[model samples]
Target chain A: MSHMFRLLETGFNPAVFNMGLDEALLRSVAQGESHPTLRFYGWKPPAVSIGYFQGLHEEIDTDACAAQGVDIVRRITGGGAVFHHYEVTYSIVVPLAHPLARENILDSYRLFLGGIIKGLATLGIPSEFSPINDISTGGKKISGNAQTRKLGCILQHGTILLDVEVDQMFSLLKVPLEKARGKLIADIKSRVTSVKHCLPSAGSEPFESLFSTTVGALEKGFAKSLDLDLQRSEPTLKELEIAAELAAGKFASAAWTALR
Target chain B: MKLELIGKPEGCKLLRLTIEIDATAGLSAMALIQSISIRGDFFAIPEEEFDALERALAGVALGKLGLEFSKLARERGLQCAGISGEGLDEIVHRHLATLNERN
Candidate 1:
C-alpha cells in the first residue's frame, strides 16, 4: 500500500510565514499531530533565505534587500543562500521512522529527490538528481534543496526555478569580489535555467498559467514517483496558530536572522 | 605561522581551513585551528554537527588532522555532500606540503 501524504497548496505568502509554516508542519509531524506532508508554496515580495550556519552579512546585501523590499530569513537547513523568487518551492516532512525516510543522508536525498526528477520529467524537462541535493537539467541547476533532521522528523525543502532574474538576484546577494560581479552574474545566468525556458510548448503563456501547469505536473510526479496517495488539505488551525507564533517570534526577528 | 588553505575537492563543496601552525620547533605542528569553514553549494544534515566536527579537530597535529576529521565524522555519523573529511585532509596536506617546500 502506498503511504498516505497530506498535500498543501499554499499559493504565496510572505517569507516569514512560509518558513514558519514549514517549521510548524515539521513539529506537527514529529509529534504525530499530523501525517506526512508535502507542501507547494511561493514567496510574496520575494525573499533571500540564507542557510542555518551562513553569516548573514557575508551572504546577503542588506541595504540592497531593504531598498528593493525583499525579505530575508534564515533557514533551519544548511546550503547556500537562495534568492526565492520566480520559483516553485516545496517542502516535505516525514517522520524518521517512516519507510520513506532513510538513515543515510545521501540515500535520503536520492530517494526524495527522485520525486522531483520525476516531476520535472512530467514537465518535459529531463533532470537528474546531482549528489548532495541538487536537481539539474542540461548540466545547469534547475533546483536546489536543503534538508534537516530534527525532533524525530526530516524536513526537506527546495525550489524549482520558473524564471530567473539574474540582475535582481545579484543585487540582493553579496559578490565574492566586487570586480567579478558581472562575470559572476553572467556565469550564473548560464548555469541556472527556469521551467519556462525549458518548455518550448509553454511559449507566450502568462506566468500564472505556466506556474500552475508546473505545479500540477510536480504534484502528479510526486504521486507517481513516491507512491504517495496524496490527499489535498489545508493547514489545521493548530498549525496556523503555531506558524503564526513562530513567524512572529522566530523567523521575523532580527536576533534569529542575524544569529550567524 | 597561520596557514589559510582552501580546497574544492571533486564532488564536494569548498572547504576552507585557517590553521595556526608552529614551525619554530623544526617540524610543523598544529598549534590551533582558528576556524574551519565549509562553503559552496553542499548539504549536511543536522547542520549544527559541522561545528562539533570542527571543534573536534581543533588541536590535532597537522599530520593527523585528516584522519582525525574522518574519524570524528564517522563517530558522529555525519552526513555530508560535496565534501568529505578525507578529501579535505588531502587538500590540507597538499597545501601544507606547498608551504613546507617554500620554507
Candidate 2:
C-alpha cells in the first residue's frame, strides 16, 4: 500500500518562520487536520539553529551573528547546531501510528533516512547512513538529520548539502577547544562534502540550475523509495496562521532561543 | 562501501561538564562542587526540569553526582536523550582528578 503525502516547496524564509512551519505541520498532522507532509525550504540571510538541548551562548557567537545580519533560532529536535545555508532543508511529519513510524529511535531514523539515501543516489553520489543520524559518502558527512516525537507525530528534519563554506561557519560558531580551532576547521573541511563536489557537471551549471535539478531528483527518489503518492500543494491558511503565531511567539522570541 | 564506524548517534550535540571546585582543599578532603553547568546539544524533555536540575546541582558533593543525578532525574520523571547521568559522572570526575593532580 502506498501512502499519500502533501509536498510543499516553500522557498527561502527567515529562520523563525522556517521552524514555525515545521511545528505547524507537525501539529496539523497530529491532529488529523492535514495529511502527512514533506516540506522543503531554505533560510534567508542564513541562520544558525541550535538543538533543543543546546546552550545558545555555548554554540553560537551572538555578536558575530547580529553584526552579520544572521538569524539565530533553536530547533525542536535534538542534535548538534547546524548552519543553514547552501542546502535544501526538508522536514517530514508522520502519524506515530503509521507503519513507517518505529518506536525505537535508531530504528526510526534508519527507516526515514532511506528516502534520502535513494534521493542522493539519483544525484550520482553513493551515500551511506552513518548511524544515529547522518548520511555520509567517501567517509565524509554530506547530510545531518535530527528527530523528535511531539503531539503524536514524528517530526524529522535534515539538510542535503549542496555547497559548503567551512571557514564562514566556524566564524559564526564558538569553538569548544579554542586552541584547536584551526585543527577542527581543517578536520570539518575534510569530513564534510557537498553536492557541487560530487557532480562533475555542477561546475558548469549555475547554482540555481543545480538546486532545481537536485530537488527534482529527490522528488523522484522519495516517491520511488517510500512508495509515496506525493500531492503538490500550498500551506493551508490555518497552517500559515499557526506558523506566523509560532514564529512571533515561540521561535522568534529571545526566551525560546536562549532556553538552554 | 563497508565503513566499520557503526554510527549509533552521529552528530550528537556534545554536552560538556564544566565544574568549579574549592581550590583551597586537597583531593583527600573530597572536593566539593561549588558550581556545575552541563552545557551541550543534548535533549531533556520538559526543558524546565533540566534547568532546575542544573541549578540544584550546586553544593552537591562531587562523589555523589552520578547517583544523585539519576535519583533527581527519576524523581522529576524527566526523560533525557543524547546524554546520561553516568556519562556526566565520569566526565566531571575525570576533569576534577586532573586538577587535583596539578594541585
Residue pairs with backbone overlap in model 2: A131-B7
DockQ of each model against the real complex?
0.37, 0.27
Candidate 1 has an lDDT of 0.83
Docking class of 2: acceptable
Query: Which 10-residue window of candidate 2 chain A scores lowest in summed lDDT?
Result: A177-186
Q: Write the per-residue lDDT of candidate 2 for residues B1-103, one digit (tens) a residue.
A: 1101111122333556666766466542256667766666666655568778877876677777767788888888675666676666655566556667888
- Scored by TM-score, the top model is 1
Candidate 1 chain A has its poorest 10 consecutive residues by lDDT at A177-186
- Give a tens-digit lDDT track for model 1, residues B1-60: 676666566555655556665656654545445445544445666667877887777667
Runs off by more than 4 Å, candidate 1: A175-186, B1-5, B18-27, B34-40
Candidate 2, residues A64-122, lDDT tens digits: the string is 89988889999988777898888889999999898788877777778888888999899
Scored against the native two-chain complex, candidate 1 gets a DockQ of 0.37
lDDT of 1 by residue, A46-72 (tens): 999988866788789999999999999
Task: In candidate 1, list every pair of residues with a backbone clash.
Answer: B12-B82, B12-B83, B13-B82
